[model samples]
Target: MRGRIIVLKHNTPGLLRRIASLRRSRVLQYRDAKGVILLDILPQGQCINAARYCSTLDRLKEAIRRKRPGLLRRGVVL
Candidate 1:
């Protein structure tokens, strides 16, 4: 991946959600538009504040379920 770099900002939680899915790494960041992410990626076996990460993951899962409405979550539960 060698090319020019780009940046983006938004008000909703879309960007963070996408990044969490693609990278699978916890990213605690805040942009100008503002995304108050408690946890970016809840990596396997990472116990960095279990309570918050679990909550964040739950919110993300709920959002996905609500939007997709047909995505059967089997096997690894996010």
Candidate 2:
């Protein structure tokens, strides 16, 4: 399966719209010039982990699953 990370130089908005077409990506490290663990993809989108919604990543997968189950069921990048 193909996978990639969402990156931003600093605090920005509307990332989901920018990469909305990409369904199987994780919200990896962002605004961290020094490099840090922003998001971690476990089994692409199907197997999302806790790290994806914490700290620098801030994916909010948990919330998405509860509120937006469709997002996860959507077709993956793979």
Residue pairs whose backbone atoms clash in candidate 2: none
Score every model by TM-score. Answer: 0.35, 0.23
RMSD of each: 10.3, 13.8
Worst 10 residues of 1 by lDDT: 30-39
- Model 1 TM-score (2 dp): 0.35
Error of 1 at 13 (Å): 10
lDDT per prediction?
0.49, 0.45
What does candidate 2's lDDT look like per residue over 20-78, in tens digits? 55566544432223443233333344544465334323344454455456756986511
lDDT of 1 by residue, 1-78 (tens): 333232444335576456545553445442212333323544555656778867766776665565543543544533
Our tally of clashes for model 2 stands at 0
After superposition, the stretches of candidate 1 with alpha carbons farther than 4 Å from their true spots are 1-48, 73-77
| Candidate 1 CA-lDDT value | 0.49
Q: Which candidate leads in TM-score?
A: 1
